[model samples]
Structure formats: structure tokens, C-alpha cells
Target: MTDRIEKIVRDRVGEEPVCLFAYDLDRLAEHVRAVVDSLPARCRMFYAMKANSADPLLRALAPLVAGFEVASGGELDKARAVDAEAPVIFGGPAKTLAEIERALRRDVTRLHAESALELHRISEAATRLGRTVEVLLRVNLAGPFPSATLAMAGRPTQFGISEQDLPAAVAAARSLPGLRLTGFHLHSLSNNLSAEAHLELLAHYGRTVAGWEREFGLRCEVVNVGGGIGVNYADLDAQFDWASFSRGLPAVLDEFPAGVREVDFECGRYLVAACGVYAAEVLDVKRNHGVDYALVRGGTHQFRLPSSWQHSHPFTVLEVDEWTAPVPRPELREASVTVVGELCTPKDVLAREVPVERLRVGDVLVFHHAGAYGWEISHHDFLSHPHPEHVFHADAS
Candidate 1:
């Protein structure tokens, strides 16, 4: 955290004290630029808005990415307002017919058909619209990923069509009018930390797509390798090796079959997670049952990532020198303080028994890498707690 960001937080706090969310757009732009610049010529980048669709974030990434991949009608509209002519790819496990109609009416690049029924719906919508529709069959591969915090494929889930049923599905899609099977979308993992393992998956996708094209004789133009580039929250020092992956991708692309022309990436968390910091004020500090605890003004309702995954959210203590309380401040030196929120549940804890040099009642705990799923996914209405201030910094180091 820089002095300028701290000042920005102070400014946002104003007279009445409350939790604050600081988003560094400058850092966001820098990271996105690095990722886009390192890409191979045949590859394309799409910002998965489901990660963080905050206006500032979308606007910052609008010019950098090839387009936006949307899951809802609202997000599609939000994407166009930011970038009027950016191509959009619509994909979801469950999509309403109205949503499909909306996507077809607009200038969508491709609708990733998640099921045979969805494929029929897209065909029906396109036929009704009197326009041909481009689509990529989202296949749920049946295997384990080399290394991942969460795996979406390899099992029967509500995500995509199973690999065993692809031959029949592809044939059915081909037979449908107003539908073109342009490629396949394989989003197999979430929070994948190994670059080598990711490369292996990419190669597997290329080989799999090639075999399908030969067996089904479909013209595959784009192989959409959905992104799960990880953020190493546990070991902050370790990060996904983008540079090495970028260098190795060209060779993998060379292994693709004759019909494959382009590769698409739909990246979400890795793009925006590092730019946000969620700051909350410590309401009180006390030792309960021989264990140290600090209660904050906010709870899982405001920031749910820690509670959702049941992980000790990494945070840094921002010391506060001002305390107007009449009672003496609760002082602790080198203590393991388990930070709990205002919610009345055991699951409201953020960081559990984390070491801190000095944490008082008025100090702030700033959770790092909260830019993606922190506020957007949290339950804001619980307990009717006041929302945190969103403070954006253009030039925070």
C-alpha cells in the first residue's frame, strides 16, 4: 500500500467512519497490458465480466481485451455501454430463451452452446431472426486436471456436455439449421497454479478438437481454452507464470490440426483480483476463552471470499493513532488475533489466528486481492449493514 492510497482511503472515510474498497485502476491497466502484450499472434483475450464488472474495471479493460464474455443479459448490456462495438461471446450452463433471443438480436461473436437443448434454442432463435448463428460446443472433458484448486470438468456437473456424448451432440448441432459449429469451449479448472499443467491441458484440447473434426468433419476455426489462471493467495510470492506460458503457447498452437485457426481465452479473476483491497475498521479487540479475537464493523455479508472458501484471508494491519473512546485501548503485542465480523455466526471470521505486530480497536484490516469476487458476490442486505465506500485510485503504486 502506498501513502497516496492510504490518503485516498482517509479521504473516502471522511467524517463518518466505515469500511472502504480501494481499487487501483493503474495497477489493473498495467497487469492487463502485460498479459495482452505477451500473447501469441493467433491467440485472443476476452475479459470474463463475471469476475468484476464494476464500471471502472470494464472501462479500463475495454480497450485492451478483444471483447467481453457475458453470462447474463444485464452484463451484455453493461459490456456494450462501455465498448459500443466490442464482440461478445455468450455462455452459461442455464440460459433463458429470452436471454438467448437477446444475444442473437445483438452482434454476438458466438453463443457457447452448453447443452443439446440450448443448441436447439440458439438454432430456433437464429432461425426466427433469419440469421445464421456461430457457436462453440462447450464440452465437459472427463478427466482430472494436473493441478487446480477447483475442477469444473472431469465429472458430471451442470457445466457442459460430456465428452462421451460429443459425437452425437456435434452431429445434432451440424444438422440444425442456422447454426455453425465454429469451435469448442473447454473451461476445465479454477485457480490452476501450474503453467506446465495448463500447457498440457491446452495441448489436450488441441488434440481432442482435431480428433473431433476428423471424425465429425466439422470446420473448427477457434479453440476456446477457457481461463483459470490462478492467483496464489496462500503464497503471495508465487504467481502464475504468464511469460513462460506465453512463450510455450506458439509451439502448442503448431500442434493443432489443419482446420484450427484461432485460440480464445476467457480470463476473469487473474485479470482484476490483484488491484483491489477491502478495508474494514476494527470495532473491538478482546481475548475470549484464552484465544485472541478482533471484531470488525463488517461481516461475511460485505466480504464473503474468506467465509465462502473457508480460508484465512490474508490481510495487513493499517495502524491507527487516533482513538477517541473514553476507555483505554486494548493493546496487544505479537498476538494471533482471529478477526471476526459483526455477523452473529462462527462463519463470519475473515483471517483466523493471523499474527500481527500491534492491532488496536481503531486499526484497519486491508484484505488483499479482493478486486474480483469480494463485494460483487457478497450478500449486502444481511443485517442491513451500510455499504462500503468504493474509492478508485488512478495512480497508486
Candidate 2:
């Protein structure tokens, strides 16, 4: 945890437990700016808003990113709310008619049509709005893809158009009126760890798309290689080799067919995962049947990534010495502990068997690498627990 966040936790005087998500906006902006700066020419970075759509984060990213990639109508509205004029790309497996109309009305930069039927939907909506909409067909390649934390295309996932159905989808995109086929969206894996592997995948996509352009006699302007860059949750020190990846981009672009003008990356987790922390006050510490557990005021309802991914989320215990309780203060020292939340369910766990030096009542469990998919994917209203306060910190000039 940063000193700014520690100060925020230390300065609190209330008897009630403190649970909040603290975002370092300055850090976020600096990280994103560096990522953007490292990209080669003709490569665009679009912020995938589904990861973390907080207003402050969006505002921080608006100028740095080429545009926003919204997966739903709600995300589209939020993206527009943050920056009225920023370019927006709508994408999702199941897009409603209302969403299609709204995207046309909102003047989105492109709509990534997931299926042939979706292409028709966009055509109908765009025609009704008297607007010509640009589109990219999202393909679920028939790939024995590189191993990753999650696979979106290799298996029978309801994510994108199957590889066999590409011909039909392309036919629909071309035949449908009020639609311009810009390129393809080939996002195969999720939480991919290797830069070299990602570069290899990009090269494969370029080769595949080039073949398609030749076979179909089509020209693609923007080939959006959907972002699956992974964050190192287990080892924060060892992260995705982005510097190497950026250096390798020119070679990948060189391999692309001349007509493919630009490559778009819709990254979400890699951009903002390291810029926030989930800090929750420890309510109690106890040993249950030979196992130690530290119960906190908050749980999976506020931050669900650890539980959803079933990983021991890395965290530090911030000792709070101010124990004004009249009774004995419960404490755990030099033990491997499972950190749990106030949720009634047995599955409300964050860290399991995490070794800690000294943890006491009122000490804060600071979860790192929580900026992306933390609160955004959580079920907040479960058990009617009060929402964690969102605390954003920025260094003053």
C-alpha cells in the first residue's frame, strides 16, 4: 500500500470498521500514459470500460486512450457520460436492439458485431437512424490457442462468431445496407501472461486476416486484436513484459498486409489493475478447527476477483494500534491465516493460508492489484452490506 492510502486508513477515528477502495489517479494516469507512449505507429489503445468504469478512472484515461470499448448499453452510457466526444466502440456477444439503436444514435466509432444476426440487427438499426455504421466481425477462431488463465475462443464459449461461420458473417456484413465492414475482432484468450505469446498471436491474426482479405477481396482498415494482457496477481514483481512487447510490435506490423491500416487494442485489466487497493478493517481474528481466519468488515460483495478467480489475493496487514475496546482484543501472530469477509457464506474468502507476521483487530487488510474487475464485477447488494467508500487520491502539484 502507498503512504497516501496508509494515511487515509490511519487518520480515521470512527469506531466503525473502515472498508474502502482507494485509487491513485496520478499513478493510473502515469501508467496509462507510459503504455500509450510505448505503442508503435498505427497502433491505437482503446480503454475497455468493462474492467473499471469509475468516473475518475475514465476521465483519467479519456485523453490517453484512442477511445472507449463498451460491452453493453450501460457501459456505452458511462463512456459517453465521461467524455461526450471521445470515440466509442460497442462490443458484446448479446447486444439488444435498444443498444444497437442507442449506439447508432450516439455516433459510436464502430460496432463489433459478434454474429451474422447481430450484423443484420446493426444494419436495421443504423438504417432506421439514417446513419451509416462501421463494424468489425468478432471471430472465435478454431484455434488450439496459447494457454491462458481463461479461454474465450478455443472452446465452446458464447463469446464470438465461430470460425466456420465467418463466411456467412462476412456475407451479411457486405450485403447488409447502412453498414461498412472495417475489419475483424480476434480476441481469443483472457489473462494472457506472455508478451512473446501475444506478439505471436498478433502475427497469426495478421496472417489469417491477410488470407481472408485475399480470399474475399476485401480491404480492412482497422484490425482490432482484442486485449487479453494479463496482470501478475501471484507475483506483482513479475509482470507482462510490455517493454519487450512494444519493441516487437513493429515486426508484427511489418508482417501485416499493406491494406490493414491500424491495429486497435482494447485493454482493460493491464491498464488500471495496479493503481488501486481494497482496504478493509479486520473485525475479528480466530482459529476454527485448527485453521486461522481473519474476518474483515467487507468481503466478496465489494471485491470479487479473488473469490471468482479462486486465488489467494496478495495483501498486507496494516496494524492499527488504536484498540479502545473494553474487552480483550483478538489478535493473530506468526501464522498462516485465511482472510474472510463479513458475508454469511462460507465462500466469502479473499486470501487463504496467507502467512502474516502480526494481525490484530482494527488492522486493515490492504488488497493490491484491485483496480480492474474489483468493484466493477462484484455483487454489491448481497446481504445488504453498505458499499465501500470510493477514495481517490492524486498528488498535488
Candidate 3:
């Protein structure tokens, strides 16, 4: 871990007093390339820009990925700015007519129609533009995921069309002249690491697509199995089982007919989570109610995962003096204390009951695995704190 941190510090020698997110562009590109290379000939990868929309990160991934899956018009613009050649696939519940028109004008590869109403809207937009729009019907597969962080794919989730509503939605889609249903889309939930869960999802989707093809007399040209590859934050030694994931998928694909159909994966967190680290500086230390507190300059405003996800980050102290270790500070000797940020909110606690060697001003506190939705989703300009800075690193190749 120290070796990795040292490599990042060495790469950014001239940069000053700025929050650095240790992003290994080469490693990120290699991860994408590996996935693309190993996947079957029909497989296609679309990077979900909602995970991290930093231009540098997108630019690094643009050359390696097949396309971009955007949830909003802003993300579409970011994808276009980075790589215009990469096809864009729009997916969201609240897509406006303007956004649909923009997607039609840009000639996106595919649009994921979420609802029956959205299907009609797309048809209307396509008629106005006088062009046929290719689309995939997003299906909701009812199942249990490991993480209970959110109610995804269940009742009250605004993600995709339910299995029962598929017939009516398909009928509506078929009624439109300019809309062509190309495939099916299904995303189970987030933070699911079990290979069995993934295999089950694929198997269910495969059979469902086969049934849809037979009923509608339309061959399914594409099957997009959404991505939720979990990251190992608590145990960095544990690596994700890509082999099991790849091996389990073929059985499901075998259910489909012997035709050239594209297998698409919209991956966001898995590609970017391991590649980023959030660095902050300690501002002050004090005692309150017989407990010592470490007040860091940075807070939930800069890194929002602690508050947003109701989770704790793996925190480490950096750039400490070896000689100062012998004479422990009063704060360090006291009982475990909460690490608060400069934010005004009482809930701005970064970590509670964190045992540290010493808490002092100018000490750097590092948060691991913060690359995914860390600064990308958590940042706000409130309280006048500057936005977090990003640093990109490339190997010597």
C-alpha cells in the first residue's frame, strides 16, 4: 500500500497542497482492454459516465471502450467532448423530449426506452426527425441482491419496466412506425459480488429474451446485462472473480438462437473505483466529552460517500515524522474520537472511533477506493470550499 502511495506522490512532484485522487490511467485502460479482449466476439462494453465524469478519466477510457452509456444530456456532452466516435446509448427514467431529440440528432447507437410513455415519446421524436430510432426495452428481473443499501429492482424503484408490463410496452413499441425494438436490458442491483447472482441473472435474462423473441416474432439482436462488479474496500487482497463471471455467462447465451446478437455491458463503478484515492489534510485536534477529535480541513462536501452511502472509508495517515512517533500527542493517547470536517453540519463526521497515532495540523489523511462516486457525485460549491482536484497517471510504457 505504501508502495502504491509512494508511486503516486513521485508522479506528482510539482503539484501543491491540493486534494489528489490517485488515478492510474494506464491501469484503467488495461482493465477495459482486458474485459473487451476476453469477451466473446459479439460482446460490447459501454462505459457508464455517471460513475466518474472527470474529463481525464473519460479521455483515458474513450480509446479502449466500445461506447458510452449516458443517463443525462450533460453526460452525453461530456462523452462527445472526450470521444465523438464512441457511440452513445441513452438510459434514464426522466428523459425529456429535448434530450430525446438531441440523442436522435447525434445518431446514438441505441436508446433504452424505460416506460410505455417513453416509448411513445421516442416514436414521436423520431417522427419529427423523420428517422427510425433503434431501441431496447429495459426489463425488470425480480431477485434478491446481497446489498440492501437501496431498494433496486423491487417495488417503488424507477429503474426499468416490470416483466408483467413487457407485453403492453412491446405492443406500444410495435405500434410506432419510427421505433424499432432491437433488444432487452436488465440490471439487477449494485454492490452484488456473488458469481451465482450474476449467473442467475444472465440465465433468467437469456430465457426471457428467447421467450420474447418467440412471442413477438422478432429476433433479439442485443442483450445488455448491466454491470455491478463489486470492489474490495475492506480487504484489498481479495480480487474480483472475473473467470467465474465469464464462464457462467456462456450457458445463458446458449439459450438464444444461433444468430449474430450483440452482448452489451454497461459498467460504471467496477472500472473506476479501484483507481482513485481521496487525500485530505488535518486542520486541528481538540477534546470534547473526554474524547479526542481530529478536525480535518476536508469534509462531506468534498467527499460525500461517508454520508451519502452511510458507510465508512478506509482512512490512513500519511507524511508523518518517524521521530514524533515516540512522544504520542495527548489526542492520540486519549480514547477513540470522531474525525469531523470543516462543514457546519453535525453529520459531517468522516469517521467515528478512529484510533490514530497522532492528530495534528498539516497531516495528510487518505481515503481509499474513493474513485467511483467519491467526488463525482458528492461535490457541492456550498460553504465556499474549492472543488476537489484530480491527478492522472500513465505508466512509462
Instruction: Report the number of the highest-lDDT candidate.
Output: 2
The model with the greatest TM-score is 2
| Residue-level lDDT tens digits of model 2 in 37-78 | 999889999999999999988988899999999999999999
Which residues of candidate 3, in runs, are more than 4 Å off? 1-18, 144-148, 322-337
Question: What are the clashing pairs of model 1?
Answer: none
Q: Write the per-residue lDDT of candidate 3 for residues 1-397, one digit (tens) a residue.
A: 3356546644443324435677777767877788777676677888988889988899888878888999988888898888776898999888999999898888788899999989989999999999999899987766644463444575558888987898899888878879988888877677666667666766766776788888978777888877777776656667567777777667767865555278888988888887777777665678777767777767888888778876666777775432234344433553475778888888887777877666565567788777798777765776988766667777652
Candidate 2 lands at a TM-score of 0.98
Ranking 1 against 2 by TM-score, winner: 2
Model 3 lDDT-worst window of ten = 322-331
User: Per-residue error at 172 for model 2, in Å?
Assistant: 1.3
Ranking by TM-score: 2, 1, 3
On the 0 to 100 scale, the lDDT of residue 289 in model 3 is 78
> Model 1, 195: alpha-carbon shift in Å?
1.0
Looking at candidate 1, what is the lDDT of residue 35?
96
Supply every candidate's count of residue pairs whose N, Cα or C atoms clash at under 3 angstroms.
0, 0, 0
